[model samples]
Structures are given as structure tokens and as C-alpha cells.
Target: MIWSLIILCGVITFLIRFVPLSGIISSDLPLSVKQSFKYIPLAVLTPIIVSDLSIMENKNFFIIDNFKLYAALIATLAALIWNNVLATISIGMASFLIMSNF
Candidate 1:
């Protein structure tokens, strides 16, 4: 049973990593379809950012009293001003930690 589970996991992992890079499935895609891949990062990040800014209380989404939302906005402004990834991440994390604590 354990070996079968390991083999199943390995096959799933291989398929996940291989299907995108194999080029076998992308050969016949339209030009627009190929170009749309450029938005993949943005598509992935939007939900993450939104979820981080919202607070779940009593099974409801609440924006009020969410310090994370304000901290993220401040960090975004800092990133725009600094234009540095490290600085942006540092500012974001620091703001998040400070806000979470108090």
C-alpha cells in the first residue's frame, strides 16, 4: 500500500511538472492563447493579495479593523517608492508582524 501511494504521488508530481514544459500540448495553441500565459503570474497573485487583506470573522469576510489591509497598502506604496524587491518584502513583513502584534 505504501509503495503504491508513493508511486501515485510520483506520477502526479511528474505529470504536474512535465505537462507544462514538454511542449507537446502547446504546439497547436493559437497566438492569443500563447500570449495569455503572460498573465499567469498576475492571475495567481490577485486572489492571494485579496485574501491577505481580508479578515474572516464569524464565517464572514470583514474589511473593517483589518490592519493587514492597511499594512499591505502601505507596503505597496513603499515598494512603489523604493522599487526594490527585498525592501518591499522586508517592509511588508515588518508591517504585517507589527500590525499583527498590536
Candidate 2:
């Protein structure tokens, strides 16, 4: 019963999200709407980044011992420099492994 409820909720959520997008993309959107949509990616990403950065268990903001943070930062720099996901992930994993050991 719980599983069925969960599945039903997921389907409803997906339909609610997709139906509008399907309509918008299928038909020609207005110029104003298209222009407004250009900021959507940044708007979505900014809050996520801020939320991740702000949420922490300890008082120290740096969290120097957290290997995941180091890995993610290194990965972000690598991605910026190389423009490659594989390289970024490899660098991140290597950093994580090195940090975890020490």
C-alpha cells in the first residue's frame, strides 16, 4: 500500500511537471517567455549551490577534513579548465581517495 501510494505520487508529480513543458516546447513560446526562461538554469543552480554550501553539521565553515568538498571543488576547477566530465570525475575521485587516506 505504501509502495503503491509512493508510485502514484511520483507519477502525479512527473505528469504535473512534464505536461506544461510538453505544451511549451511543442508550440511556439512567446518571445518574453523564451527570454525569461533563459535565466531558469542559473536561477535553479544558484539556490542549490547556496543551499549545499550553507548546510553543514559543524561550526567550521571550511570543513577542511571533508573529502567530498575537496573532491567537488577540484572537480569543478578541472571541469572549468578541461571542459570534460570524465576528467573532472577522475580528478575528483583521485582527490577524494587521497584525502580519505590522510
Candidate 3:
């Protein structure tokens, strides 16, 4: 049952990711639809950011002492400054490790 559930979840995830691309590539999307597609990344990211910022185990509005949050912020800044994924991840991980020890 566990294996079946995992397989089912994997398939569903794969289909969701592929379906949009398949539709776009297989058919000529209308101009408005194509324009709207450009905002997909922002649409996906907004919910993730909202959930990360607002959701907490103890009903806290902010995670002030959260090392991961600090690390992520540092990473974002590094990415903005350098425009490099490796640098951002490295900085974020370094921040996380340093902050976690305290």
C-alpha cells in the first residue's frame, strides 16, 4: 500500500508538471493565454512565500530566531548581488550552519 501510494503521488506530480508544457507545445495557445503563461512563475512563488512567512507551529507571525529564514534571506541577497546559484546556495548554507550553532 505504501509503495502504491508513493507511485501514485509520483505519477500525479509528473503529470501536473508535464501537462502544461504538453498543452502549450501541442496546440497554439491564444494571445491572452500566452501572455498569462508568463506570470506562472510569480503565481507559483507567491503562495510559497506566503506559506513560508505566515505558517508556524505555535501561531507565531514571524520566525525571528529561525536560522533557515536568515540563511534564505542571505541567499536571496547573494543571488541578487552576484546572480549566481552556486554562490547563493553556498552563502545560505554557510549562514545556516553558523546560525544553527548559536
lDDT of every predicted structure (CA atoms): 0.84, 0.81, 0.82
Order the candidates by TM-score, highest first.
3, 1, 2
- Best-to-worst order by lDDT is 1, 3, 2
Write one digit per residue (lDDT tens) for candidate 2, span 1-102.
999999999999899689877775555768898799879889999788645644365664756676777778888999899999799989988998998897
Model 3 residue 50 lDDT score? 57
Clashes of each: 0, 0, 0
Model 3, span 36-72: residue lDDT tens: 9789999999789657645465676567877777788
- What is the C-alpha lDDT profile of model 1 across 10-90, one tens digit per residue? 999899689879976765779898799899889999888887667676789777778788778888998899999888888
Using lDDT as the measure, the top candidate is: 1
TM-scores of the models, in the given order?
A: 0.60, 0.55, 0.61
Those runs of model 2 whose alpha carbons end farther than 4 Å from true positions after fitting are: 1-28, 45-55, 58-62
Q: Regarding TM-score, does 1 or 2 come out ahead?
A: 1
